[model samples]
Target: MNTYRLQQLLYEETDIEKIQKKKHNFIIDLPKYSFNYQNGLLTLNDTSFFKKNEYLFINKHNRYAACPKHCYQFIELNYMFSGKCTEKINGEKIDLKKGDILFLNAGSKHAISSLGKNDILITFLIKEKNIKVDLLSQTKGFLNISMENITPFFTDIFRDKQYHVFRNNEPLSFEQTLNNIIYEYYFPQIYSAEIIKCNLLKFFLLTARRSEKSCPDSQLEPHNSILLSQITEEINKNFKSLTLAVIAQKLNYNKNYISNFIKNQTGKTFTELINIRRVAEANKLIKHTNYSIAQISELVGFSSKTYFYSEYKKHFDHLPSHDRQYSAAEFLKV
Candidate 1:
C-alpha cells in the first residue's frame, strides 16, 4: 500500500487523533453556503468550496461530524479503501464498503453520516474540460460507441440533474488503477501528465465496460453501424489517400453527414482521426525500418514533411529523429 505517499500528498498526518484535532481548524474559515431544496431536490449554491486546478485534485475527505448536503460544478469520484460509510443521495441511502467507488457528477448534491475513525475515502475532483482534452483524445480505437453517445451517459452518471448511484461491482482493477494514478501524481517524472491521463482513461473504460451489463439499455443504439464499420474499414485500409468527399461519394452519403458521423461516433473530427492513425503508422516505421523521416511521412499519407513533424510532435511529444536515434542506441546495446 502507498498509504504513506497518499498521506504525504493529502494530509499532514495519518494518526486519527492528530487528524481529529486539526479538522475543526480546516473548516472554520470555509465560506458560508446553504442547501436549497427545490423540486424535491437539494442543491448546493456556493461554488467556492473547492479550489480549482488545471488538471485534477486528489485529497482525503475530512472527518466531520456530519456532512451537509452539497454539490460542486466539477466532477467528484469517491473511493472507499477501508471501513464503511453511509451516504444519502437524493432520498436513497447507499452503504459504501471497502473497495467500493461512487461517482458523483456535477450538481448532484448528497449528504453523509458521520464517518468512522477507520473509514478512508479518497476523493478525485476533475474538471470536465480536462476529461475531454486529456483523456478523450487517446480513446480512438478502444470503444465502438462515439463520444456523442458516451458523453450523455457520463453526464447522466455524474452531472445529470437526477439521482444516480454508479458503483463498481469488480473493483480490483479499479483499485490497481487508482494506485498507479496516486503514484504518478506524487512522484511525477517525465511525461507524468500523459501517463496519468492514460491511466484515468483506463479507469473510465473499465468502469464503462463493467456497467454495460447492468445498464444494457443505456448503451447508445448505433444509428448507422454498417456505414460506420465500412467507413472505418476504408480509412484503415486506404488512409493514405482518404478524404471526406472521397468517403462520402464512395458510401453514397453526403460529405457533411460523413464528417458529422465520424465526429459523433469517434469523438474526433475526420481529419484528426486520419492523422492519428497515420502518425501511429509513422511511429512504427520510425522504430523498425531504416527509412528517412521524409520517406516515412509520405508512406503514412502526410504530404508535407513539416506538417508530419508537427503532428508527430503533438502525438508523441518528440520528433522522429529522436525516436530513431534512441532505437539505434538500443539496437547497438543489444
Candidate 2:
C-alpha cells in the first residue's frame, strides 16, 4: 500500500484516548515506573514486544504529550509520515513537517510536542547490539574487540553526539522504502528479516547522503552558504532552462560574479553543476524507469543525445545503457 493509505489505516486503527489511558495507567499503576528525565534509561517493559528474532520494532507516536523527556537504550529513527510536529533538541525547537526524519542516538535526551490528528509519526527502534554485531560480522576475526568495547567503537564512528534532522522535500522514494520495511516487519515471510535488513541499510545510506548535503561543514561562510543554497534551489527548479545569466538576473547579481561564486563554493562552474544535476536525474530515470536514454536526456534538460551521452559518461564513468543493464541484473538477483 502507498504511504497515504498506510497512514490512514494507522490513524483509523489507533485510538488516541486509549493510548493516552495506557500511558496514564502505566505511570499511576506502577510505583517504580517513571518517564521523568532523572529515572535513568526508559526501558520499555513490554515482554512480548521486540522479540529476540526481530532486529527492529515499529512504534506509532499518537499521543498529544507524546512522551516525557527521556532516553532509550536503542537508536530511534523518527519519520514524519504526514502532518507536522515539533522536536525540542539541545535547547533548539525544530519544526518538522511531512517527509522529515529525526535520527536520535541512544542515550540522547529529547522531547516531542503534541501531534495533530493527521500527524503520522513512525519510529523505527533499532537495537544497538544488532548494529554492532552486523558491523563486526563483516570482518569476522579481523578485530578481537570484546562486547564491552562495542558501544565505544560505535560511538567513535558517530563522533557527533547531537541529533540529526533530514528534510526530504521529495519523499516518494523514501516513503516507498519505508513501506517495504514496514511490510516486511509485519508479515514474516521466508527471509523477511534479511530483506528488512537490506532495506533499512539502503534507507540509512540514502539518509546519510542527504544529511551530508543538507548539513554541511562549518567552514562555509554564512553569506556564501545562503547564496549557494539559492543557486542550487534555482537550478533544481529551472534546470531545464537554467543559465548563469538567467540566474544572475533573477537573483540580482552579476553573471560573472554568480559564475565565479558557484565555482568557488561548489568547485564546479555553473554549466558543469547543472550538467551534474541533470545527469544525476537522468541516471535515476534510466535505472528506475523504462525511459530510453534519449528520452531521459531530454527530460533532464539535455538538448542533444550525443552531448548527453558524453556528459553522462563523464560523470558516471559508464554508458547509460550499461548502467541500466547492471541495475536490472542486480534487481533480478535480489
- Tell me the deviation in Å of residue 54 in model 2: 4.4
Candidate 2 lDDT tens digits, 1-334: 3555555566763555466645642231223542333333244432333666455788777554455455666677888878888886644578888778777877666667767567778888777677556644643675565433433323432444456666766542476688788776665689877777667656655655454444444468888888889998999898888988999999999999998888777657899889978988999999899887888989999999999999887665457998899889989999
Candidate 2: list runs displaced more than 4 Å.
1-5, 13-16, 19-49, 135-161, 170-173, 212-334
Candidate 1 stretches with Cα past 4 Å from truth are 1-4, 7-53, 139-152, 156-163, 166-168, 216-334
Clashing pairs in 2: none
lDDT of 1 by residue, 57-156 (tens): 7667766455656676667778876678888765558898877777777766677666666777777776777667655566766756544444444654
* lDDT at position 146, candidate 1: 49
Q: Compute the lDDT for candidate 2.
A: 0.69
RMSD of 2: 21.0
